[model samples]
Target: MTTDQPVRAAVAAPGGPRPPQDGPDRGRGGPDRPERDGPPAEGPPAEEARRGFLAKAFGVTALLSAAGSVLGLLRDLLLARYFGANQGTDAFLVAWTVPETAAPLLIEDAMAFLLVPAFSLALVLREERPTGPDPVRQLVRATLPWLMLVLAACSVIAVVGAPHLVRLLAPGLADPQLAVTCTRITAFTILPFGVAGYLTSALRAHHRYTAPAAIYVAYNLGILALLLTCHAVWGVRSAALGVAFGSLLMAGVLVVPFVRGLRATRRPRRPCGPAGDSLVLIPLAILPVAAFTLTRQAQVFVERYLGSGLPPGAISHLNYAAKVSQLAMTAAILIVLVTFPVVARALAAGDLTAARDRVEKDLGQATALVLMGTAFLMACAPSVVALLFERGAFGPHDTAVTAAVIRVYGLGLPAQALIGVMVRPYFSIRPVVRRADDPAATGRTTLLDWYPVGAMALGLLVTVAVGVAATPRLGALGLAAGNAAGITAAAALLMRGLLLRGIALRLPRVLGGQARLLAAGVGAAALGVPAAAVTADPLLSTLLGGTAVILAFAALGTALGAPEVRGPVLGLLRALCPPSPPAAEGKLPHGR
Candidate 1:
């Protein structure tokens, strides 16, 4: 597929045609293979092709992500075995918050939110039989330098103020000096992470997905390797070093692909004037997004701050539980990453129908997937936690705490998935004015808007209030509850905003599917709990209980006609055992 084609159309069908393999712009082959040569495929062929491609892409990504997640789980297991939930672990977690918080702002979801739309818009404008210079290149040149400068400045601030920052984030810490040292080491990651995020945005804008998707795997592998090799020398601080080195490794993985993408799209420079003015809209767009990101990240701040005041290891418990809960969340996010760019590009081109269709489809499928995962996780929380992290310093007591927290967090998985899906539409809605006479209208509007900001702010307030009130009495469980509540409220507001903006969500169908999914989940839990009770070993219990839950959910879901279950099951079958091509009319079949 050519760069000028809409991203949706490019991946819309499978086995259609493949693009030239030798072009300067040719990206590394992975999940998103090029379409077939010749005219675009249409009708059922196109639809089936798209579905097959999506299935393959989703499968490949999920497999790789699951690998990374396993490594992440192993990292936690080792940490639990080696360090336990003590002052050192708590201190490392506290210091870890810098990257955790900054990630959303610099290179994770936040950057995706701003840059996807910006890059999509740039792509759209560049394709418009240009009257002057290339807007995409112009936007990149204008924003990248300043973005790097800001990232550098933040890193310096974080390094210099590490001690003060640690005090503010975890005032009750038992070892402030140790945390400060860890914080300083982690601080250096901000710069490299920013560079990685920028490169990721650029690649995604060009509709390249493989390299960006592999980033986390690369990062986790780096950390896992470093921790194993250097733990004896640096102790817990080795984790901090792993973080910094991993980030640089993450950035390094994308360099060649990003440069190739840049080279493919490179164009002659033109003087900045009306064409370049659209570049200013990027930062403007980033502001409200940045605010929304900060508010979302603040939820973490609230959790950690309140958790710090609780008994020692409260923060670590929360961290471990969150990792287990996030596995499902990560799956939902991978789906979003694939679909969001298509939605953004559609909206940028002013095709609301396409954008709306994509959003609704993504929302339903992602929601169903998360709900099923939540059921499995919540039903088998104890077994799951124990199987993954119940070795070494992590005993039954620690397992119990983490399991309880995971169950509470399971309540909010649907809301978290929905929030991720719902937020994309608002970002994808570009302001287009019909009056051609207006000189000020540069074919785009500022990126930051009130809808996302207001929705997120309201959510943040609820999270802080609930967290503050419940932490003293209920401890880490309270923090989990607060997070669930805040995210649910935010998801609701965002959904309502979409409705008000005239984006039809087909509410009745969506709600019906969800109700059925919930029923199936409940039914699954009913069977799974007993199956688990029959087993004495944690690993065996998890295997038995999880299998029972998944099978029940699948049977009930198919009986209830849930698309989420049937679609994937069928897709996987089709992918694994494809049909044979038709024989020639005059020729006998091979068997005959």
Candidate 2:
């Protein structure tokens, strides 16, 4: 598959792998044919076509993810109104930490980053020898059993040790017992989430994105339903139970699609290859990725742990603020998710240039979106937080603290987006050797592999040190600042590492684009701040001010000639209202 082809479902040919039909047209002519064109035709419009496909796919995924985020927002609203940032909510948030920490390892972007490339490589290799045993199937079969075993052991440990873990995560909680009970209920989600991760990887490999994208929506919906129906009876513990049930529901939602994807790709197979032979390479690939995830998650753990030592509501404040700040980041991540598998596929096929191009584009676009979001959120943090979470048990003071924390977190949105895009290339880098027994198989052996882990470690250390040092004085604001510093450092290190490995990022161009976006963002804030100030009602202020800000950003971005802004807008317009057909021959009398 070349860059100019629409990513399509693979079909087997009798002789070999069939050409993907969705690619650019190669005019039919043997070498014997006379030349007819004035200039030699360039490569088929594959890049443009692929971009169109991505744009449409991203638009759909964004809509679904936005819907899920809304549900998540509602969940937070209920938690705030019903419980506020009190001991009960704090206890629940502590229990929630289990999933928060485990998600990156299982159902979040880290899992996708690690597995997509592996699955892509397996699929490509299998396609090369269509009649051979399917490597993807073999790989999954070999890996799943071990995954289940590890998951089961981890779940048992977590269940048995929930009390100890709760004490460790939030030592200052007023109601440690409630947290322990909630932790026990939430611990079981680890196994289901692990299963969901595998299913997500499988679906994405087959280019089946709808089901994977919808999994979060389903998960959130399940939680919302349970909380509504059972919260009265079960209290805050209901939310914990909801999480476990939701994880199962999340995985359940993907099973049929995953199975269908497998059936579509299935071929008559001989006995599978030596089962454990393929298993060695998986751990080799996963370990560094896992290390990176652990370090990232550790930052959150550190923040919450330190926040616990603050006022009673401090943990809940941090959680609420972080969730609101994350809304934009989550949307940016969903947009980038569309590109991960494509970049991985390119790398698996040994097209380094294509992979690099995809990474650069994804980084720029995600950054632009995130920065725009940062500008809006930071400028209107108070109004936004107040509108979203100021009613019921969530009082004005809670809104003020949460808003401040959100503003601080907004400072890091661009760095977060950059890390999200940059890390994928490292994960997608094809290994030179697969043998675990090889002396050079250690992760640190190559700069390509070692730098990401090193960057992550450095970031984690900075986060813990800064968070621990500052939280006592500045509370959640200090923690948010530490997170920003840490991620910024990580993003810089990752960019530097990529450059050292000769992957030129054309940093000047990227920075220039970012500068334009920043200018647009500032211009938007200039207009929005007053719009927000003029209104006394928080909801009215947010709606009116947000609309003005968005309009200003779009206008300034277009005037600045930002492709990241213009391209998507144009693509969406085209998608919604396609070009009109040419007037019929000699049929324009009415117009005349």
Candidate 3:
């Protein structure tokens, strides 16, 4: 089946993916059915319609992500004002690692990598054999229950071993007790994080994105509310309380839509796919994916580990800087989040060319987006930091430290975005057709294709080595540099691995395009800084710098003949100022 059909967002709508009207389980899509249950819409109109829907989805996601980030910004501001960048904040951030690590496994990386493809395959299977047990429901029942149990058990283990975690993660921390207390509170997030991730995977697989994207908004709102209400009594511990409570809200918001979607589908039969066939291939495939995630995230671990021995507020500075820098990467990554399922479905259909094109396009687009963001961020880091966090207990000294660290993190944003782009194809949806050699039965991608973990492991080791060498003299700056170096190395290796793993992405073109974008970004930053310096006010300086970077990035990109970067810029311009159609014979309609 051609994968370019209008990707109906109703995949999770109970009445969405229905069989023919006369077909069994006939009460198909309820009131919200987008199209009839038949062959898909085709031609240019269909294509345009598809683009419209995807654009809408992307917009909705961007809006929700921005909302969450705003709330998160407020939460960070509250912390900066109340807790300040001190030993207490450092200890609390150490506990924050609980939710951080859990996010990749349960919410973002491992779960989505494993399940989006699985759910996509299940949807395919259901479409193929409509009369049989619904594979979607079957997959959920077989995996979700056991998955929740494992996650809950992990949560309990984390709570029990909070002290051990604190010691291992940050041995030299001055306030280990506070860190331990915070870890114990945040440990409860494992269950909620797992469930939320699982639900997000399921929802996205069915073309449902609103609830998934709203999770962060819900999460940050929860944190902002709890932390504010409890700050006077709870002190720094309020941050941990917010994290735990917020995670619950993350999962809670998705429940109704998840169940509603489930109910709309047909009931399941006992025997689903083949005899003893499984929907989730977690037992085997998860090892490398999980390892890669852990290793990549270990940059933070390494920083805090080494930073613990530094001054009391060093870790806090790194965390604060990282928060600002990540916004650039996050905006770029939204492209991948929306298109990941398309790539998965393409691969599942055995359409390598389609998947290759999709992945390549997404990489270039995301790269351009992030490079521009980096230009703005690195150029305006000082002004941005002062404007956001210089009030209350946070002062000019803290702002200087955070600005320096954030620029280092900003330099790595493109690498982060690239890795996000590449990983989708690395774990593309496998074919559901089972093979005798397939023990996990997930599909073509397997343990032998475990290069990402090794690559990330190498990066983490590099991070550790670099941090150890530089942390003593440079302090948090050294740690920030280590993170940048490691991620850049990993991003390069992952690019080459795509070729080795038969992904068919043209590395020369991709690298060349990146080289051009890098030049454009540098130019953007170079000009943006001077433009920012023209203003004395922090907020005004940031605005000027940000505007200058966009103008420079776009102009320099087009001038350098980088169409991959140019295409998106032109599209945005047209969207803002569409031209009017010419009047026939030079006469305006109904005039004179």
Top-TM-score structure, candidate number? 3
- lDDT of all the models against the reference? 0.76, 0.76, 0.80
Error of 3 at 559 (Å): 1.6
Superposed by TM-score, candidate 3 places the C-alpha of residue 79 at a distance from the truth, in angstroms, of 0.4
Per-residue CA lDDT of model 3 for 516-591, tens digit only, reads 9899999999999999999889989999999999899999998887887688778998999999977689666785
Ranking by TM-score: 3, 2, 1
Best by lDDT: 3
Better of 1 and 2 by TM-score: 2
Cα lDDT of model 1 by residue, 82-128, tens digit: 88988899999999999998788878777777778777776655554
Clashing pairs in 3: 11-206, 14-264, 15-29
Q: Model 1: how far is 89 from its true place, Å?
A: 0.6
Candidate 3, residue 158: how far the Cα is off, in Å? 0.8
**Candidate 2 — which residues are off by over 4 angstroms?**
1-42, 270-282, 431-448, 568-592
- Write down the RMSD of candidate 1 (Cα, Å): 6.9
Q: What TM-score do all the candidates reach, one by one?
A: 0.86, 0.87, 0.90
- What CA root-mean-square deviation does each model show from the true structure? 6.9, 7.6, 6.0
